[model samples]
Target: MAAPYRSREGLSTRPGAYGGSSDEIQLRIDPMHGDFDEEVSGLRKQVRKLRDVAQEIETEAKFQNDFLNQLMEKVLMPTALRNELPD
Candidate 1:
């Protein structure tokens, strides 16, 4: 299961990519929308923003985990127990 994508408009939208399988559910899109290009531009911008946000989150999580591990080893570990951890 994947997380639902959220757009800048705060609307939760299914991903724009389509599965080629014939059994997949088809969604109805508004064909009469004023400008298709504008819609695509908006979606592109939202996707970029989401990608950047996800990357930032991943980097931050890694940094925090590494920091916590170092902090624990240096401050929480007893001298006798330090050797128990793998180098």
Candidate 2:
């Protein structure tokens, strides 16, 4: 009894590193003609911007976690351990 989306092979929503140029390639959505190529280019630029932001956030979170862990081990944990030691 497993969920359809979860087979342990990873999530289906994660776009692959090389998912191909479908996003870059354009399709004529309207017969009358909208600049579909330009639209796709804009969408690709926005996706790139979003990816950069996500990477920055991930880096910041990692830095904060590492800093807190170091502080706990170097300062708080040492002091607590020292207090607990018998004379």
Candidate 3:
């Protein structure tokens, strides 16, 4: 990427915006680092909770399907045989 404007002149020896000269630039820490970690941790917790709920729903569905199959075998099979056996 190109800069907004190219500087033909080299480094200049002048006073900086702060108390020091331009050669000595100050390093600063970003303020959002802690907030970023907190947000990630919260998101992880929500994902874990969602996974647990999905597993529970899957287990309940399997159980209900098995119960329905058993009920059909016990209740409907005899009725179907009786209908075919007589008027």
Model 2 is weakest, by summed lDDT over 10 consecutive residues, at: 3-12
Model 2, position 44: C-alpha lDDT score: 77
Which residue segments of model 1 deviate by more than 4 Å?
1-29, 79-87
TM-scores for candidates 1 onward, in order: 0.57, 0.56, 0.56
Clashing pairs in 3: none
| C-alpha RMSD by candidate, in order | 7.1, 9.5, 20.4
What would the per-residue lDDT of candidate 1 be over residues 1-87, giving only the tens digit for each residue? 232443333344343458543332222346674456776787678679989999999999999999999988877668657778688
- Predicted model with the maximum lDDT: 1
Residue-level error in angstroms, candidate 3, position 82: 0.7
Total clashes in model 1, counting residue pairs 3 or more apart in sequence or in different chains: 0
The parts of candidate 3 lying over 4 Å away from their true place are 1-34
Per-residue lDDT tens digits for candidate 2, residues 1-87, read 233333222212333359752223223345365566765686677679979999999999999999999987888877899899998
Question: lDDT of all the models against the reference?
Answer: 0.64, 0.62, 0.61
Q: Which lDDT tens digits does candidate 3 get at residues 1-87?
A: 232222222212434568663343222235654455654575577669979999999999999999999999999999989989956
